[model samples]
Target chain A: MNLRIIKSGVLDTVQDQGRYGWQHIGINASGAMDRFSAELANALVGNDSAQPVLEMHFPAASLFFEQPSLIAICGANFSAVLNGEPVPCYQPILVNKYSILQFERLNQGARAYLAIEGGMNIGKWLNSYSTHLKAGAGGHAGRPLSTDDEIRLNSSVDWQSYLERNEFRVLPWRASDFWEKEPVDEIYILPGREFSGLTELSQLSLTGKTFTLTPQSDRMGYRLLGDPLEMQNREEMISTAVTFGTIQLLPNGQLTILMADHQTTGGYPRIAHVISAHHSRLAQLSPAEKLRFRITDYSMAEVLYRRQQQHLHQIRYACQLKLEWFIHAGH
Target chain B: MSLTIPYHIFPLGDSAMTVDFGSRISPELNSAVMKLYHELQLTPLPGMVEAVPAYSSLSVHYDLLYCSRHRPAEQTVFEWMGELLDKRLRKLDYEEIIPSREVVVPVCYDISLAPDLEMLARERNLSVEEVIHLHQAAPYRVYLLGFLPGFTYLGETDERIAMPRKMQPSPVVAGSVGIAGRQTGIYSLSSPGGWNIIGRTPLKLFDKDREPLTLLKPGDIIKFVSISKDEFEDH
Candidate 1:
């Protein structure tokens, strides 16, 4: 199966879970920014959790399917339409050959994830299909999708019979609720080792204030536009390893949170880390979005993460069973 | 001789932890960090995925789900990791591993490739030849790789030629060799850099399709050998 890109939309790229075990060598773990939606899209179509999916930013892509295929769209609702008919998010749908899938505009969130039934037939670099744009390696020629680009899909069991029955068929079930639809403005964080380096006022300002995401934000980090935070002492720290969600306080008192394409090491003071469970929600936040921080302990953060994992596990199992029944029934 | 360097391990996030060796950058501290990193690579814990070693720290990334399975039901992933790391730290031998073959990096210091050589020499009140002599006089160690893939951060250039980074970074070419604040490194990719460029290398520092991907690794010893522009092109 193959799909031609009619419109490449803003920053469309293929991403899996992430590239791991290579950050030690200064490689960024580039992957889908909103993993919650990426996984949901895959689950809806019975694809593996780590399967590569198309991550489309606001003003998403328009794809023309070359073959009848089963697909699912999740994450930000971009007001998707299949052959000019409105299509819903978070559920699997079958599209016939020559059907055009277009996303008109963003209804919510910053990104949308589209998953094909058998995953994209893309080559992986360092064990991931994620595109690291800076390095020009991995995923669909190591860059964002461009107009007329053709993405190959794995050949699954014949779906031509199903397509003949209907031009477009919507699955009866949807992914169970795990992520919140409402934009999450309050994000929980844990104090970093250098958190104490900040003054009392600066510390209070961090949790007791709202900050706007600056236009300077990108995959590397999200720079906040608000009151500059100050540290008690201006000490030069040796460069150390940083990870996704690591919050660094800049010299100018601005705060930046490292994201998926962040460097391995940073010199700025690390003030806090956004909890892992909220990383997906944070990824959906666009520039100019207002957000407030809340302090949480390690134990509470762990509990929340485990709960979210359990929820995803249940959803995966349910979807697998439903898909097996659909196949066994010869649909 | 074994060195006893004090270090502290702290949680970076839910899935990662950082072991900070010290605040100052020293050969001993870097060795200690690399020693710990190698030991972990040899015998990684159940869930540990990667351990990134920097100048004075090592950030260990792990799989939370895999780790949670091995820990007691009541224990959190962080607690379990802390206990495991503590056990490993207590038993580290801190033996330095010597490289069998020295990696010789060929550099062309000709005026065409050395964009900032004159500026760096003027700032240090030394001749361009003197600057090159000092830079290639001694072998440098690859302390760490960061900022870009395969960008090796070599260290401990002669203090006489040591200088601060430029106030504003200018666009640098790939394979450019630069110096700033007592350290010299080769830029694996073309990027805007603050470091003063004194030379360029013809060899590719990073290649995704290559087996090792990076020509240099942490703890590897590097000796810069100056070559003629023609020699550089031939290589």
Candidate 2:
């Protein structure tokens, strides 16, 4: 079975939990910027979280399904429509052969995850299916999907009789616990290694003021514009290791949050770091969105992270039981 | 444990932690950073993912969900990992050094291929031949790999050949051998770069199909060998 791309959207590429254990050689872990949503998409389709999924941006790719399959859409709500009919996200849907899936308009978020059961038949580089754009390796010939590109499907289910009366079927069960969370406009963070190097005013302003994500942002980093921060004294820092969610204060006094594809090391002053649990919220935020930073303790961060983990676990378990029953019913 | 270097460990975020040596670039400091990185990789903590070594610091990334759930209830994952790292550092023996791989990178310094070679030599009040000689005189240590893949940061070039980065970034071809301040590097993939390019290497520095992906790794000792234009294209 092959899924044909009718129209490719901006920055649409194959992504998973990202390529890891290669940063020491300047290789970045270019995976799904929002892991939770990607994982949720997979779980909803009864696939493992590490399976590769189609990560699309606004005006996402219009696809032609070659066979009947169970799939789910998560992350940014681009108002996915199947064969001219609007399909809801965060739940498994039985898509019939020759069905056209399209993302009509940008209703929310910057990127979306499309996960199919048994995953896409894509090649992996460095043991990962995530596309490393810079290196031009991994996933669909290591490039963004263009029109007429065909992606093979690993497994196909016979949902013809089950969906005989309709073009598609939206399953009753949804990953509610996984999909619902506290609305996250305010991003939670912890002080970075160089947080204290900033002037007292700058330190206070980081949390006190709101910053706008500039258009210069991408998979590498999110450039933020706010008060020009400065340090007590000008000191040249030796380059050091940085990670995803590290908020570095540039020499120009502006700030940039390193994302999934951030360099292994940086020389800028790291002022704060966005908590792990809020990375999904941060990744979904489109360019030009305003966000406020809140300084929280490590204890609070740990609690929130554990809560998010529990949510993922619950959703995975809930979907497994429902998927078993649904797949059997289709037979 | 001959702990001569002073270092501090801190959390980059809840998911990652870093151990930094003092703020300076030297063989001694980088050796210590690599040692810690090697130790961490060999005996990783519970849920440890990867350890990245830089000029004078090492960042340790981990599985947050695993660490958070498996760590002692009283201690946060950060604290638990920090304590583990502290124990490792306290017992870290810096006496034995990890064997570094020696690599010879060939650079074609013909006037046509070396766009900025003349300019760099004129500014430093030296001839182009002098600049090339100075650059190739010593074996530089590969301190770190960042900014780009296969773009190894080999350091401590002769001061006479050192130059600041270009005011504006320009398109640099892959295998461009360039210098910025006292450090020199080879451009792994073609992109915009600000370094002072003196020559180009014919070797494929960053091929995804290549074993290890990158030609050089941290703690590597690399030197540049001058070659003619014919030699550059022959390979």
Which candidate number would show the highest TM-score if scored against the true structure?
2
lDDT of 1 by residue, B122-153 (tens): 99999999999999999998999998888889
DockQ (Cα-based) for each candidate: 0.77, 0.84
lDDT of 1: 0.88
lDDT of 2 by residue, A97-200 (tens): 99999999998888899999889988889889999888898988989999999999987556677786778999898877333566567899999988998999
Clashes of each: 0, 0
Ten-residue segment with the worst summed lDDT in candidate 2 chain A? A176-185
Give the candidate number with the greatest lDDT.
2
lDDT of 1 at A140: 94
Grade the docking of candidate 2.
high
Candidates in order have lDDT scores of: 0.88, 0.88
Off by over 4 Å in 2: A177-181, B1-3
**Model 2 misses residue A195 by how many Å?**
0.7
